[model samples]
Target: MLSDFLALFFPRFCAACEGALAKGEKVICLQCDYKMAKAGGLTDNNNFVAKKFFGRVHLQYAWAYYLFNKRGRIQRLVHRMKYDQMPEIGEFVGHKLGAALLRQGLQHEFDVVIPIPLHKSKLKKRGYNQSEYFGSGISKALEVPLDAGAVVRTVNTASQTKKSRLARWKNVDSIFDVKDMAHVRDKHILLVDDVITTGSTIEACALSLQHAGAASVSVAAMAAAK
Candidate 1:
């Protein structure tokens, strides 16, 4: 077949480790998949992720797929996915997280999924919202539809890396607004994102959904800070 001939000429490599991968392997090799940490606290109320946003936002549940340590494999995976236009990596992680949550009956608790939206400028430059790609994978695994444009980012804020927690909160406040509330009103919303560092972005998005009359909000991401 033509595909087989192309594969023989240009074999794919793992996105994280950059090592040779098998014929069907994608961003992560099989070995790395087994080694990657899964989200264990997804349904727990007192998980660290929920605790991080304590007093800032009222989350029904909050969890992430992997523990992020700088220079670690998880970090490498996220970096490649975000910076290299490897959208498949985000979806892969999302599927893993979604499947794990599905096993615990977590999928049924939410009625809808929404990705943390990126600003139009950034999205235009990147050509994709990594979080939406992640959400799409989760939606596919859960048999749910993703509301892609449910939330819109209106302001372009600077990086929150070096900012203090309070400053990060200020930077993210009012950056997002909800669209089409009739579709989301009175429904449980599962907010999706690629990662949760300071929790500012998700909190802002959650507030917008809450203002739009969403019954409840839960958060999921590909990874979380350790």
Candidate 2:
């Protein structure tokens, strides 16, 4: 009751568009909700994200939820979730994305969901892994457990922005280490991330998992940068 009283005077607002949201609303206004582009939840390999990993990661399936561009609403949404302590935004998008996959009968193929790990120092500074927050939402919707510890980032690498494809791959080559190979043995792992640019980070993580005995790997993200 006290919480409700406080809410009456201070209603929550959408993180992306900054509009007043009704009680229990998380983030993104109703109008902005309609603006979101569903990249793919269908069973097809022609999606933009799947094309990026073709012949590279051998994904069982791959897809992203939005086409991200500079100054676009999708970019703004990602920025808020990554830097603004708005985990609800990630969770909200993840749930909708998961539901879409479920409708397409694609959510049952994965045995486990794993988020790309950040270096320990970076996690300490950021207080959270933004990708993990999205994985949690998908895990809840898909009734699968999240393996947040399946992979570990061993080095604090420089940002990939403005870096060439070869440079990014070099930076991520030896930066990931697999943990507890036994747990991931013969499993189809779904690797999650906030975004995919050149995909070096996801590729590195997939390689580490493959070496550790993963049967297959699929990938997902909140958005894909073009």
Candidate 3:
């Protein structure tokens, strides 16, 4: 077939492992997908992601799709998604996670999905928000509205990659503002993000939503640093 012929000449590679993708595979190959370090027990209230914000922000639920390891396959995939113009990877992962959540009967828990917004300057440079795409996928799967405009990032803070926990909190503290509180008011918000490092950014965003009168806030991320 022409499709087969094209694949023979120009094979598609897996985003995580860079291995040739077999038929029926998209983005990540099955082997790499199976090998991914899943963050299980998502339905539990005391899961790892929830514990990260125990004393900081109140969360109705918190879950991450994977446990991030330095230089691991997930790191490679995330790097490509954020810096290599591969935003589809985020959506792909989000869709898979969303589907799994749906299977667990969690679809009705959240009223809306809101991705953490990027500052306007960074959004202009990236041409897209990876977290938004992730939220879009979840929104589609959960049959909920995806509201990227409900909140905005006021400060373009320095990277938290090298900062300590307290420093990270300070950097992102009070940096988020609710744009139209009406949209989030009385709604159970599912806050989506690409990664949860020190949990500072998410905490700040959740606080902003809570202050804006959001009925409840939950957190979901593609991965969390181990």
Best by lDDT: 3
Worst 10 residues of 2 by lDDT: 1-10
Clashing pairs in 1: none
Clashes of each: 0, 0, 0
17-114: candidate 3 lDDT, tens digit per residue: 99998879977899999999998767799988899999999999999998987788999989988988778788888888899899999999899999
Model 1: weakest 10-residue lDDT segment is 1-10
Q: For model 1, how does the per-residue alpha-carbon lDDT over 87-141 read when each residue is reduced to its tens digit? A: 7778877887889888988768888889999899999998889898899888888
CA shift at 153, candidate 3, in angstroms? 0.5
Write candidate 2's Cα lDDT for 1-226 as tens digits: 3224434554388666778886556566777778866566457877778888777778877778877777768888899888876666777787777787777777678899999998999899888898998888788888778999988999888566777878878888889998878768899998999998777888888888998899999888998876
Instruction: Judging by lDDT, tell me the better candidate of 2 and 3.
Output: 3
Q: Per-residue lDDT for 165 in model 2? A: 78
Off by over 4 Å in 3: 1-11, 159-164
